[model samples]
Target: MVADGIVSAYPVDPEDGPPVGISKDDALTLKALMSPVKGALGYSLEDARQLYLKERIGVGEDPRRHAARNRLAKLFVRAEAGGLPASTLLVDLTRQQARDVRDHMLTYEKPGGGKVAPASVKRDLTIMKAMIGHAIREFDLIKAAHNPFEALEVGISSGGEEDIAARELKETLPDAVIAAMRGNLQGELNLIWGLGSRHARLSH
Candidate 1:
């Protein structure tokens, strides 16, 4: 059956002097044997590889490239995951990616302080998505195409209203979290961010 076909593709020992391949007949037999169990570990392949690498070939693992996510913020995380049990480096990398997406969104405006064009909106979202994707890949997180600013159909410069911008930014998290790169809330979508200095104050 199909089970035997997958098993036949399993890597085997090369030092066994070119051992006989898992024949079609044996494949059928293995298929019948595997029908009951699904996705079973056929053999202890991991231990064998480690042993072979240690005994037959001793090689040092690379350190430079695979060390951190970005060279600029390498110090933010650390060379080795210290305090954190599950790879602190990975967590740090994701945080930095989130920050970048925020910074990109903040500065999205024209030189003359006009509205942000439709082109710019899509571009900024794409850039943010690319960074987010990198983090997702690193830690293996599920991602969706849901837009936090779904109602934001306009492109306007935030620098125009400095005071309101500050207030709106704070209201994003309510805990003074100035770096809310991603948000997914239902009802009362914190319109402070979308409005300028005039709408900065909360309606009584």
Candidate 2:
């Protein structure tokens, strides 16, 4: 029976040495046992996050990277504690789940009883989205896929916008104009540049 086959897949002890050189029939039985449950669609979020952390640490770290890893770890720990199973698959994530997490991040009190900051919630959501995207790409977990994070509307304002703005400026603004916009521009100059950017977008 399939149950018996799956049960047989478990090893007995280290003293017995590793299981190897099994018969082709036994190999097939083992593969069937190890396969994901029916309807299981993607890698677990816990596994994916760990993979992301592993890759980041592989490149070594400076202060900023270390801080980022710590922040992300805190989020994952919080998520698991909030009843999100470590076994929950990334592809199973919905907008409702994303919003649930966002709401928790925004309102949950710390061990000191202080509420989480809006900025911190925003930053963590940004990191969460990027982490999911990176994990999917790196592992080919999904094929020809729609990213759950792509459509997530985490109500925070600042998350991921810096990267978007940088890309937009690179594509739309000339090098000389970009250089000129640097440093402290007076209020008038700021308004002028903002209006000019809007105009450029409309013209394009």
Candidate 3:
């Protein structure tokens, strides 16, 4: 029987003497340490995401890029509303659950309406993969263990085909129209426009 916050453990051999009493806190700590999940107690996905963003900021990353990454990171927390419970500790997250997150993003709908594009879904997953990977390395988790988000194939179509199709469908602007637009632009604006036009020409 148990009393207070102490648990009794008995040895198989009667010659080993009386049962040992362990406090619940010590027992929980032992369990957490022995569990294969890894990571420190109470460390969660949201915590990892915040740390990752801070690291990026420290490296001089742009605010806009940080905002974009934050949006992607929030999807994991939002997933809890869908019953995924992504706010749990990294150690508790399984490969199947990671795949489920990918599926959720694939089927996610936009605020204005319509489903998210597959390309965008791929990008989101890629960003998440990086974030999780960063957490795993930064936390100094089990060296032999692989990250749950690693090598998940987003399976997006090749960009080459899309680019070719876009180019084929685009209507070329006439020289007169280009001349008129360029003429209305100011000094710096005209230089920027010229550079943009040159880059576009070079791309083709």
Candidate 4:
């Protein structure tokens, strides 16, 4: 018999023997055949987060990247406190839940006072979307088309031309100011900054 694509393997009584008509080896074979399929859909968000971090560490990810992921996890924990529980299974995550998560993130306040910036909220959501996408792909859970986090908008802007222009604006010090700042710096710091500036110019 099969339910939800899972077949019922032949039963074996460990303390006794295989049931009625089945031999031990045949039961074993059935049991092996019916082993649970592993995938991200079977994991809770927190569990998947842990697995992702563990994998990154195993592959020697940079310390800063690990710290950033931990920060994101903490943010998710806070969101859980607000309503979006980390115990939510990936398979059960609905689009409404994803929106609720974004809403909670937008409501976060810095320790000093101000609400989190829209840009920061957008960035956090982007990272979260990427993480979930990676987990889905890594576990071969489902097609990329099925990712619930895909194409989620943080509602940061009205998509106005002015907003676009403001975002694209570049702020930089004048050449004279840069030279003055370099002159004020001492030894190795100055050397490093000079080399960096030269490389930046070369790249551009």
- List all candidate RMSDs to the true structure: 19.8, 11.7, 10.5, 12.4
- What TM-score against the true fold does each predicted structure earn? 0.21, 0.53, 0.54, 0.53
Tens digits of per-residue lDDT for model 2 on 9-66?
A: 7664568754545664554455446554322334668877788877854445688778
For model 3, name the residue pairs that clash.
none
What is the C-alpha lDDT profile of model 1 across 91-177, one tens digit per residue?
A: 223433343344344444567876445445444444334433444343233331222222333233345433233334554334344
> After superposing candidate 2, which stretches have Cα over 4 Å from the reference?
1-42, 57-61, 109-114, 144-146, 156-204
Q: Rate the local accuracy (lDDT) of all candidates.
A: 0.37, 0.64, 0.64, 0.64
For model 1, what is the error of residue 90's alpha carbon versus the real structure, in angstroms, after optimal superposition? 11
lDDT string, candidate 3, 1-204, tens digits: 132223234332367643356554554455465563553354567767777777853435677876766675576665564355645676666788777776666666778876666666666667767777787678765563446778876654323222133475687688899899999999999999899889877876
Question: Model 4: per-residue lDDT, tens digit, 128-166?
Answer: 677677676676666422456678876553222121334
lDDT-wise, the better of 1 and 3 is 3
Off by over 4 Å in 4: 1-41, 57-66, 143-145, 157-165, 168-204
- Between prediction 1 and prediction 2, the one with superior lDDT is 2
RMSD of 3: 10.5
TM-score of 3: 0.54
